[model samples]
Target: MASLTIRQLDKSYPLAKGARNLVLNKIDLTLHSNEFVSIVGASGCGKSTLLSIAAGLEEFDSGEVLVDDQPIQGPGIDRGVVFQSYTLLPWLTARQNIEFALKSAGYAHTERAEIAQQHLELVKLAHAADKWPAELSGGMQQRVAIARALSYRPKILLMDEPFGALDAMTRRQMQQLLLEIWETHRLTVMFVTHDIEEAIYLSDRVVVMKPAEIDQCIDIPIERPRDFSVTHHPDFLNIQSQIFERISQPLEHA
Candidate 1:
């Protein structure tokens, strides 16, 4: 478990006239140890940008980002990331994919094999350990990607719409599997997605982000061990509506 804190974060890209396109603005957020938080927003709202910065994949223009109160230097072993696209090395088998990540974390050949097998089992992909990425279905490939990400035992996990490319059924299944793993591991997770129900189903709190800043954050009052049935609960729909209202807020006229 770890603490992630971002204070007054800002990020912008250069525009045609040397002006900047502000993508993130004074984004302040914190995830307590073992908390599952999801960031949701309309397209082009900088949700992925914020997540990327936290993963140390991109730099912010200003403000401070810290993990466990320590300033992030760069992409470190302390954080693991999974994205919509399965970023697995194609030539490697499922098990080998995980082993490859462990190797970079400085595990010996023997330990890499052992740890790889263990994580594959954690994601219930042990049966397909030897299958190449091409042989695995979309869901199966994602499982392998998840296994590889977690094999190193990173303190926090950042997922950027990891289930976005999956079909509806597979997306549901993956969400269930992810929640199971999160519960078992007691992890600090920051997930970015455009799906409201998915966020409500998987997150302890859903943070609604505006185009260039956070709009609001709503706590999910539902009980844990969530399932599809939770979607039918009135409270779930109510929270979902609240988030929708925030996301749909119109920008002020210039």
Candidate 2:
């Protein structure tokens, strides 16, 4: 069954002279249960905007977005979002940050601590659970953000370049950790990124978008439990090259 469905979505922003700036146009996408889908495109392609809309953090001008067949009205516990920024509360420890989300989602106060600790360990951050965002590394902070998002057990995880600010090594580590989390939880994920390799490596399908609409939906076809070694494989390189070509093509011709 489809976990998230977006149909003919249209969004626009008002311009200076009362003109409308079209952002997303006639966008349609459907993500099945436990599927990992990534959206990649050039800057100004409305990638983040689409993700925000899915998170119910932004409104659309037309069309419909649904979670399990129910139209999205606004932000809810059903959708969890993580952005490029770590977004952790500076005053809270890693564990407290996740516990905050759990509390807001109506989890029992007594159980929140244990649940938060479990999620921290899920992201391999149990060792740093007591550390504040300032004391932790960038990667660690993002892991905490992810743990907080998942702590509520949202139906879908919406990530907008969640690792964009991390170092290369940390980015790779987070990607591996995310893959493991998705596999373990059987999550339905919608990821947005500018990194082609990251998208291909983590996604079952890549949705290539133009300025306001989807250009193509490319299947990775790579076997799972993937590791760093898969990056050097011939199939991986070929798929990367193809996505690059699509991304580099002119918008009018795309």
Candidate 3:
């Protein structure tokens, strides 16, 4: 099983000359195996930075990040990342896009094509497997991106506001599709989103962040196979209220 562990992680960005702006400060978080966790916070609070660090895309000044007891030195095949933008190569067909990743995962040339097609169908995009990125709609493109990320069988899926650009209905549809894939494969997922209801509905726990640290890690407690209907559940509303309250308040420095 894949599990992510972070302890006392710190990140900062340098400015002009000698000044630096601290973003994530002394952060500690752990995502257990087969767990779904979503992070929510205001902009510029280093939410994305933290995820980038976990993906081994960014450097940390202090602390450690380990996946299944192994330290992450840089980006590895064990982790797959999906960004806010589609990040697909415009010229490549959906199947080709997935094939590109499978190539890096070291699959044989013949094996790559078959694996790519399988993942396309997994994301329900087999019919559009031959379509170019420019030819597909936003939602469909994101589906292709998801298919590509999963094609190599990464142990963890790191998503950074992947559906933030989609329309409401399409976003919901994608969410359901994601849940279906998750249930079937049970890959450890760490999703970052700005939507409170979406976080509550999709995550096993909701991580509330302040500027440089987490304020709370609220457990969702809501039963799985959850649909949009969970949004109206009494406990769901209560959890939403809790998250809203945490975010609305000003950060308290330690």
The window of 10 residues in a row where model 2 has the poorest summed lDDT is 1-10
Relative to the true structure, candidate 2 reaches a TM of 0.97
Clashing pairs in 2: none
TM-score of model number 3: 0.97
Off by over 4 Å in 3: 251-254
Positional deviation of residue 154's Cα in model 3 after best superposition, in angstroms = 0.4
lDDT (Cα, tens digit) per residue for candidate 2, span 130-154: 9989999999899999999998889
Q: Which stretches of candidate 2 lie over 4 Å from their true place?
A: none
Spell out the clash pairs found in candidate 1: none
**Candidate 3 residue 224 C-alpha distance from true site, Å:** 1.1
Could you tell which candidate, 2 or 3, scores higher by lDDT? 2
Please list the C-alpha lDDT of all candidates, in the order they appear. 0.93, 0.93, 0.92
Poorest stretch of ten by lDDT in candidate 3: 245-254
